[model samples]
Target: MPLAVYLLGLAIFVQGTSEFMLSGLLPDIAADLGVTIPEAGLLTSAFALGMVIGGPPLAVATLRWSRRRALVWFLAVFAAVHVVGALTTSYELLLVTRVVSAVANAGFWAVAAATAIGMVAPDAKARAMSVVVGGITVACVAGVPGGAVLGQLWGWRSAFWAVAVLSVLTLAFLVRVPAGRGQAATGLRGELRVLANRRLWVAFATIALAEAAMFGVFTYLAPLATGTAGLPASWVPGLLVLFGAGSVLGITVGGRIADARPYQTLFAGLTALTLACAALAVLADSGPALIALVFLIGLLGFGINPAMSSRAFYLGAAAPTLVGASVTSAFNVGNMLGPWLGGVTIGAGLGFGSVAWIGAALAAAAIATVALALTLRGRQPVPAQARA
Candidate 1:
């Protein structure tokens, strides 16, 4: 990998921190802005909705621009929006900033993935992607917690200020990003045509299902850790640290195998995910077993990103940028849907441990989706260009 690839990862680290730090700061934001916690929670949802709605159009609009320029512009807007957010006292204004900042953030991610892959060899795409996506896991471990501490010490606004500073620092590395000579410009019509493929849509759905499986259980992990696992409230932080560590390890292992054996890796990852969730569903009351399963769930749950992203790249070779955007949109959609589904399960009187069952079922659905894609590949004739 080139230095540019690592810099792209660093940019993701900044964006990921800003993206997730909102969760930690919600209580402070709610109190200060005179909104309920649920209303403050809407800020998080608004950011995700912005990402889902904004990524593709942004990708299309920036088709003619150089990836380096797009990246720089997006980060500049992101930093600016965070500054505005830090200064705003109105909840309504804060919500607007969150959405606008997320638009910028979505555009940055769409370009970043394409840029990262473009800078690496075809065989190294998964490894490169792992390094980039690893930024999010690192954010969960360090950035979110740090933001909470910053919020406690100074104010919630301080967390936003810190993110803005990091974004600015990250922009300095954009000079290393390689310049392009109009490849994106030449593909407008052909790239748009790629959207017609049923296979590509299936690939998008697969990514969504996989993420839903992961987040369904993850969104309730703290509660599960305390209630079912019988751990102390203070242990939640350590549990988060453990999960993040497991995710990093999973990404590393998945990257090594995904490029050459994408579906094999997919099956392996989902299988591990299913088994881990199933164990949690059944043995969550046993402290030792619950602890081990939580770590395994974290490891196996996130371990599929390389395979999943690699699959998207393969399916969307005609429009890599759109594929990048699609992946981002799909993940956010899953992020929202997963927690909602888990919430429904709990509201229906299934305990927190039932979230693991829901998660396992979601993973099983992903596994079946992968199998369906493979079956369709065998039964249906490949498009001439696809075959080529």
Candidate 2:
């Protein structure tokens, strides 16, 4: 890996922090803005919606631009939006800022993934991806909690200010990254054509399903830990940190093996994830067991990420930037879907433990989706032009 790859990861770390930090600031935002807590929560949904709808179009628009230029522009926009969000008194304006920030973040992610992979050898693609995606897992562990502490000390706006500052610093460092368009710098038409690949859709489905499964359980983890698992309320943060630690470990290990044996790695990780969810559903009453299962769930859930991401890039080889955008869109779709499903289940009077059941079912579906992808790949191998 080159220094540019690590720099891309650093940029992602800053963006990832901004993405997840809101979980801790929602109450403060609602109180300050005179909105209901649910309305404040909508800010997060707005961000996810923006990412889902904005990424592919942004990718297409920037297809011919230099990667470094696109990245720098996106980072500038992201930093600017956060600054606006930090200073806004109107919830409506803040909501718009969140959406704009997410769109910029999505654009940056799409370009960054393509740029990082372009900096590395083919055989090292998964490892390079792990380095980049590891930013999010690390954010879950350190950034979210740290943001909460900042919110407590100063105010929620302080956290937003912090993210804006970090994004500017990251932008400064990212200026040194290479400025070339990636290998698949095909024009808009060629990139759009890649969207017709059935196998690529299958890969997207696998990624989406896997993420839906993981987040279904994760969204309600604090409640599950306190209500069902009989843990102290104070223990929730530590459990979250533990889960994040497990995720870092999982991605690290998955990165090393995914390139060598992608399908096998997916199978092992998804299967373990399904089992972990099932175990959590059944053993939610046991505090120690619940704690262990939370860590295991995070491990197995994120462990498959490298394989899924590698498969997307492999299948969409003809349009790396567009495919990267599509991958980002698919991920946010899952991020939205999983929590929605969990909320529905809980609203229907199912216990928090039921989310684990939902997780299990989603993971099983993901396993089946991966199998279909493998079959599709076997039937129609990558075209020679794409392999070029």
Work out the TM-score per prediction: 0.95, 0.98
Per-model CA lDDT versus the true structure: 0.84, 0.89
- Identify the leading candidate in terms of lDDT: 2
Candidate 2 yields a Cα-based lDDT of: 0.89
Model 2 alpha-carbon miss at residue 249, Å: 0.5
lDDT of 1: 0.84
Q: After best superposition, candidate 1 residue 205: deviation in angstroms?
A: 1.2
Top candidate when judged by TM-score against the true structure: 2
Count of backbone clashes, every candidate in sequence: 0, 0
- Stretches off by above 4 angstroms in model 1 are 181-187, 380-388
CA deviation > 4 Å runs, candidate 2: 182-185, 385-388
Cα lDDT tens digits for candidate 2, 10-41: 88888888888888889999999999999999
